[model samples]
Target chain A: MKQFLNNLALSLVGLFIVGGLWALLSATVSPDLPSPWRTWQESKVYILSPWEKRGEMDQGIGLMTAYSLFRVAKGFFLAILIGTPLGFMLGSSNTFFKMFDPTIQLLRPISPLAWLPLGLVLFRQSEPAALFTIALCSMWPTVINTMTGVRAIPQDYLNVARVLRLSKWRQFTKVWLPATLPYMFTGYRLSLGIAWLVIVAAEMLTGTPGVGGFLWQEYNSLIYSHILLSILTIGIVGFALDRMMGFAETKLRAI
Target chain B: MSFIELKDVSKSYGPRNVLSGVNLTLDEGEFVSIVGASASGKTTLLKAAAGLIPYDKGSITMAGEAVTDFSTKASYIFQNYSLLPWLSAFENVNLAVEAAFPDWPKPMQKEQSEKYLQMVGLGAALLKKPSQLSGGMRQRVSIARAFATEPRVMFLDEPFGALDALTRATLQQELTTLCRSVGRPVTALMITNNVDEAILLSDRILALSRGPGATLSPAVSVNLPRPRGADLLMHDDQAIRVRNHLAEFLLAGSDRERPAQRPEAPAASKDVPVEASI
Candidate 1:
């Protein structure tokens, strides 16, 4: 409890320092930059009534965040479903690794922007295209991490599997899966972070109704304060998502 | 009857040979230990006999069946405990029990696991994971896992080598008791650097020569009576003789100049009767 309070106090102090600096900048050197007070006042409607909808592009901050979260969830789960088995195969089979590793390495660093047009051509719909971009961009982490996890299973544990004469199926389920879980989770966490990041860019390009969409829409409208609000919401949500994954990873390691 | 036999076993890693012309046999219900210095190919020999790794030459057989791979009839206790960190004590043991007796009812498997953990004095720690347990306790869980399978032949590769002297002695005693009390006789093959542990546990002790290519010395019979303890080892003359033979073989093979002093026995053991060991 004391540690938590200490962290909270420190966080508040940090926020205060950054806020004061921003206020000072707006009042002096950058007069066109919105001050903290002005931003808060202008953005209060979104904060106070986060689920409200004024128009097609004017939904409250909560609704926008929820939409972005939904798309990320869909894409992240899709990445997991495909990437996990791919990783398992790559990790366990030398032939599979030799065959696919080069291709995966070649494709891994391609930007979501580069993939978006391809997604659009294949899916022919903005939503699927956005999801395709999000999944493809985020999947590399899960695939790589899972493979590394499988590779990293302690030799003693594998020896135990062999000594017990555990059937291949039992070895996969009991030894391989459990041993790989913590690593797989690390992959999932990274993948989710990537998915969240890709959703913003995907939504920006696709004009979807989400946090990224709201940021783009407000920027086009010259609503500078709302753009700040969207950015803050994205930062806070991404932090929360990461913390949730970290908590899960801790639990897995304890197991 | 010979329960498990390995004749002229040899193994190599790349260009370096680990074991060469290693011949060993364990009679039914016998407990045999191979004592050697570190890196003397003890683990390689144990793994070869258990069929965990393929030997370059020679045949291993259990009950007249040629051993080409790890036999389901055997169980292994590794030096490092090797308990799954994700599993509780009961679960670790239960996993082996389930594999060894797959057709048995789940409740029966659970019962068997609980019984073995309790036998190892881990009834209170049944729910504890390996990380939550101390080194001694984790090894107890590994021992429980090994015995729970009711393996026909047990291979122990320096099972207590990682433990402190006190914990190692305590576990050696517990293992001795467990071996004697189990319902059916189990043929055990163990490897260790500890001469006293071999004296305390085995019916016979063999020495593995220093490696590039290690070979087993002829067996030295550990004819000390059963129900042995660390105290008995000091009190008995035969124990001293066996310890010296094994220790000398080890010291002779190693490059080290001086032997480390053995830990002092408890003062209370001074009053123990010599006849008690006989």
Candidate 2:
């Protein structure tokens, strides 16, 4: 509890420093870059009435963030569902790894931006296209981490599986799953971060009615304060998502 | 025929020979100990005999059937307590009991696991994972798992080598008692660097020479009374003689300065000679 309070206090101080710097920069150098105080004033109406929706493009920040989060959650879940087994196959079989590893290596470094057009062409719908881009980009971390996790299972544990005469199914549930959980979670955490990152860019490109869309719309209308609010919301939401994953990982490791 | 036999077993890692011309046998009820210094290929020998790994040469058999894989009838206790870290003491034993007797009802498996954990004095620690337990307690969980399976053959690979002296002695006694009280005789083969441990547990103690081409020496029978206490073994003249003989053989193999004494060991122990040693 004490440690949590300390972290909270430090984080508040960090926020203050960033706010002070932004205000100073707005006052002196970048006069059009809305000050933190101005951004708060402009963003307060949406913040206070989180669920309010005036129009399709004028929804409250909460609803916008919720849309973004839902898309990210869907894409991230798809990544895990598909990537985990792919990782297992890659880790366990030399033949499978040899066959697919070069392709995975080639695909891993490509940006979500590069895939966005491909997704649009394939889906012909903004929401699904955005989701496709998010999943395609975010999946690599989980695939790599899960593969590494499977490969990292100790020889002693494998020996135990053999010596105990555990059936193939039993070995998977009793040995493989538990051993790979922490690493799989690490992959999930990273994948979620990437999903959140990709959703913002995807929304900006596709004009989805979410936080990223709000930021892009405000940018066109020259409303810099609301753009700052969108940026802050994205950052805070991403941090919260990472914290949730970290908590889950901690619980798994405690087992 | 012996219950388990390894005839002319040899193993190598690339070009380096770890064990060569190694021969061993265990009768239906015998407890044999292969005493050796560290890196004497004792573990390699034990793993080969247990069918956990393949040997490059010769054949291993269980009741005249060539052993191709880890026998379902055997349980191995590892030196470092290879209990699953995720499982509680009870669960670890229960998993093995479940695997070994798949036809048994869940309640019966649970009962057997509980019985063995309690027998190992881990009744209070049934819920504790291997990470939560001390080294000795972890080893106890391992022992309980091995026994709960009701394996006909037990392969112990330096089972108590990692514990402190006092804990080691106590566990050794508990193991001896557990082995004795089991319903059927469990043929055991243990390998260790501790000569006193071999004398305390084994029906026959065999010395394994130092590698790169390690081979076993003639067997030194431990004829002391059953329930051999550590203190009793320390004072017994026969135990002292056996300990000295085994120690000298081990030291001779490891010593750098002394000319290699090519003792005309029994046919079972004679390897390709020590000419390859640096």
Candidate 3:
């Protein structure tokens, strides 16, 4: 309890320092900049009654956050569904690895934004273009990590499996899956973080009904306070999602 | 018929031969130990006998049946005590029990796992993971796993090689007790570098020349009485004599290249003079 209070006090001091700088800058250097007080007041309008919706482009902060979250979830889920099996095949079979590894290596380093135009052209829709960009960007970490995990399984463990003559299904479930799990979770966490980052950028580009699009729209009208509010929302949500994945990883490790 | 037989067995990796013309035979209910210097292909020979690896040129049979791959009737205990890191001690043993007796009920499996673990003095460590246990304790779990399967043949590759001296002695005595107490006959083929360990545990000891083209020496039968403990071996003049002879043989063979043709069998225990040294 004492440590917690000390930390809280330290956090408050840090916040005050930042607030003081922002207030001074806004007052003296640039009156156009959103003051800390203005940002707080503007953020309250959304935080107090966050579910209200006016129209397609004028939805509440809550609705926009939900939309962005749904897109991230869909893209991340698809990446796992596709990437995990490909990773297993690549890790297990030398022939499969030989065929696919070069292609994966060539493509992995390309930016998600580089795929955005192609996704937009192919899908011919804002939502799907965003999803495609999110999925493509998020999948590489999972594939690479899962492959490494599978390859790292101890030879002794496999020898044990062979000696026991375990059925193929049992071998997969009992040995391969558990052995590969910690690595897979590492991939999952990285993929989720990348997915969240991509979703925001993709949303902005697609001009869809999400937090990124809302921030872009607010910027167009020069509502710096609303833009600041959206930035805070995005950062807090991203941090929460990452923390949730960390919690899940810890739980699985304990098991 | 011999319970386990390896006839003219040879294995090579690329151009280098690890073992060559290694013929061995063991009777039912016999405990045999193969002692060799490091990298002398003792492990390779053990793996071939267990059918874990294919021999380049040879045949291995158990109970008149040609063996290929790993046989379900035989269990192997690795030198490193390869317990899965994620599993508890009980879970590791339970997995083997499940594989060896698929049709047995869960309660029976649990009982058998508990029984063997208790015999190896790991009953208190059932819930501990491999990382939590000491090296000696981990080996005890592996030993329990090997025995719980009740295999007709057990291939142990330096199962006690990693333990400290005190732990090794205690486990060796426990293993002898367990072997004696089992209801059915079991033939154990173990590889070790320790001459005293071989003398204490084996009914007969087979020495190997150093590789890359290793061949077995003629078998030296241990005439020591059963229920033999370290104390008995310490006090017995015959046991000390046997240990010295085996050590001398290993030391003398260290520098010479193994002969291309198989050497003639060395004289058995009866031929060696009681007063002979080195």
Model 1 residue B238 distance off true place after TM-score fit, in angstroms: 2.7
The TM-score of candidate 2 is 0.94
Candidate 1 vs candidate 2, lDDT winner:
2
lDDT (tens digit, per residue) of candidate 2 on A1-255: 999999999999998998899999999999999888888898899899989999998989999999999999999999888899999999889999999999999999999889999999998999899989999899999999999999999999999999999999999999998999899999999999999999999999999999999999999989989998899899999999999999999998988
Q: Rate the local accuracy (lDDT) of all candidates.
A: 0.87, 0.90, 0.87
Query: What TM-score fits each model?
Result: 0.90, 0.94, 0.90
Candidate number 2, chain A TM-score: 0.97
Give the best candidate by TM-score.
2
- Give lDDT tens digits, candidate 3, residues A1-255: 999999999999998998899899999998988898988886676777789887886777898899999999999999888889888889899999999999999988888878999998999998888888888889998999999999999999998888777788878987998999999999999999999988878988888889998999889978899888888889999999999999999999987
DockQ of each: 0.70, 0.86, 0.58
> How large is the interface RMSD of candidate 2?
0.6
Best by DockQ: 2
- Candidate 1's residue-wise lDDT over A1-255, tens digit each? 999999999999999999899899989999867887888999998889989999877888888888999999999999999999999999999999999999999999999999998999999999999989989989999999999999999998898888777789989988999999989999999999999999999999999999999999989988888887888899999999999999999987875
lDDT (Cα, 0-100) at A76 in candidate 2: 91
State interface RMSD in Å for all models. 1.1, 0.6, 1.3
Candidate 3, residue A169: the lDDT equals 83
Q: Any runs in candidate 2 off by more than 4 Å, and if so which?
A: A1-10, B255-278
In angstroms, how far off is B246's CA in candidate 2? 1.5
